[model samples]
Target: MIRRKDTRRMAKRPTKPTKSVEPRRAGRGPSPEKTAQTRRVIIDAALGEFLENGYADTTMDGVARRAGVAKGTSYRYFPAKEALFEAVVREKIAGALIDADPANRRPDEPVSTFIRRTMLVSIREIERNGRAAIARLVLVEGARFPEMTEIYRRAMFEPLLKQIRDLAATARARGELRRPELEDYPHLLIAPIWFAIIHNGLLDRAHPLDIGDLFEAHLDLVFDA
Candidate 1:
C-alpha cells in the first residue's frame, strides 16, 4: 500500500490539546442547593449593597464580592446589573407578598385581627428591608427599566389584591363591613396602610397624623364594630 507524501506529512503534524474541564464547584457546574444558596447570598448581599451604593454605582463584581462568590457566579445567576437589581426587588421586596395570602388567616380569627396582622407583617417587611429606600429604588429603577414594574405587579400586587378583594366581599356578605360600597374597591381598603408605608419611606418621620389613629379610622370607616 502506497500513500501520498502529502498524507504522510499531514499524519505527522501535531494536534492542539483539548481545553481542561473546570471543577464542578468552580462555576463549571454547581449543585441545585449550591445554586440556590448562591442566588440567596447574591440577593441578600446585592440588596444591602444597592441600598448603600445607589443604582448607577452598583456593579456585579461588587455584589459578587459582597456575596463572597466568584464574579462569574454572580453573572451565572444574573446576566446584567439590571437583572441583579430586579432580583433584589423580587427577593427582598416583592417576596413579602406571601404573607398577604388569605390562607394565612387563622381559623375563626376576627376579620379586624386578620387585616391588622396581614398589613402589619407586610409593613414590617418593607421597613425592615429598607422601607422607603427600597420603594424608591424600585420606582427609580423601574422608571428606567419597565420590566421591574411588571415583575412587581405580577409578583406582589395581583396576589395580594385578589386576597384582599375576596376578604372584602366576605366581610360585606357577613355584614361585618360598614361600607359595603368599598368592597368593590378592595384597593381602597388597603390603600391607607400603604399610604402610611409610603409616608414613612419618603418623610422619614411621622406624617402628622398618628398612624394608629389613622388605621383605626380606616377600620371604622370600612368595618362594623
Candidate 2:
C-alpha cells in the first residue's frame, strides 16, 4: 500500500526516543504532556513547511515560523532536519497504530467481531487522520528521503502486517478459516483496504468504501469453500 512519494507525505518513525529524555534532567521546563503536545504541534507545522516548500526547500526556521514557536523551541524538539522529518512521520503513523489495537472491545466478543471492529476503526483512522496526504508524500517524495520510507515500513506498515498475520493464524486455529493459501488470505483481505485508501488520495477524490462488506466478502471467498 505504499505510494509514490510525490503524491503523499512520507511516513514517520513510529516512536521518538529523544522525546523521552526528560526536560527536567536537562534543566529545561514543562509538564510531560505539555512537552508532548508542543512536540506534536512542532511536527505538524514542520510537515506543513515540508509540504508547502519541498523537503529540499524547507528549513528549520520556516518550520519554526509556521509553528509559531521560536527557532530554538523547534530545535529543542528536532535538532536536525532529519530528526524533525522523522518526528513528523512518526507522529502520523503512531496514530494509525493506536487505531489498530482492539483492547477497547469486549472480552467475550467473537474474533470476527474483534476483527470487524478493528478494521472499522482503521477505516475511520484512514479517513479522518491525515493519512491521504502522508501516503501520497511517501510514494512521491519518499525516494529522496529514504529514512522516511524505512521508518514507515518498519514502524507503520510492519505492525499492520503482523496484525493480519496474527488474525490469519487465529482464524486457522479456530477452524473458522481454511484456504490452500491461508497465509495469503490476510494479505488479500487487507491489501485492498490499503490500496483503496491510497487510490482515493491519488485520484484527488474521496468515496466511502464499505469495510464490513469488503471484510465479509473476502472471508466468504477465502474460507467458505
Candidate 3:
C-alpha cells in the first residue's frame, strides 16, 4: 500500500523568480557620465595649454598630462591635435556666449549701465585670464581651422552685436539715445574695450579711458544733443 501511494503524480506548479538588481552607480569612473566629465576635463586642459603655449606649441601629450589622462585616452576623445585645439577654442567661445545671455536682453536697463557691465566683464575676462591669447589663437588658426572661427563669430560675437544694435534701436525709438548709427560702427564702439584688454599687460601704455565712466559719458554725449 505505501509503494502504491508513492507512485501518485504531483500537479505542476509555476515558480516565482527573485527580482533582478540594478547596476551600481559608477561615480566618476569610466561609465557614460564619467566619460562626459573626462571629455570636459580634456577640453579644459587643452584650453589652458593652448592659451599658455599657443596652438603650434600645444601637444596631445601635454594636454593628456594636464588632464591626468593617458595619451591613448586623449586620442580616443579628440583624435588629433588640431581637433583638440578647435574643441578648446570652441568651448571657450561657447562659454562667452552663455555668459552674455543676449536673449535675456534687458532693453530697459540704462544703456550706459548695460555697456559698463558687459564691457567690464569682457575686459576682465580678456585681461585676468590669458583670454587675449585665446582670441589670438582663434583668429590666427581660424583660417586654418574654419570651424573654430565660425563658431567664434557666429555663436559669440554676432549674437552680442545683434543684441546691442537691437537695443540701440529700441533706445532710439524711446528717444533715450541719439543713434550713433552703432550698426555702422561696431568696431569703433567695441575698440576701446579691446584696446584696454590688449594693452593691459603693458607698463606706461596710455590706459584707455576709464571704460565704465567713458561708456556712460559717451551715452550722455549721444543723448544730450
Best by TM-score: 1
Q: Provide the overall lDDT of each model, using Cα atoms, as 2-decimal numbers.
A: 0.72, 0.69, 0.67
lDDT of 2 by residue, 103-139 (tens): 5446566556676666656655554566655666767
Measured on C-alpha atoms, candidate 3 has an lDDT of 0.67
For model 2, the run of ten residues with the poorest summed lDDT: 96-105
Off by over 4 Å in 2: 1-28, 50-57, 102-108, 180-185, 203-225
lDDT tens per residue, model 3, 47-88? 888877877788999999999999999999999886786576
Q: Candidate 3: list runs displaced more than 4 Å.
A: 1-29, 138-151, 201-225
lDDT winner, 1 or 2: 1
Q: What lDDT tens digits, residue by residue, belong to model 1 across residues 1-225?
A: 975577665676677999998767745576889889888999999988889987767888899899899998888889998788768776777666676666777867767778777665555455555644766666677787676667667766677788878777767666677676666776876677567755765655654334455666777766763
Positional deviation of residue 131's Cα in model 1 after best superposition, in angstroms? 4.6
Among these predictions, the greatest lDDT belongs to 1
Better of 1 and 3 by lDDT: 1
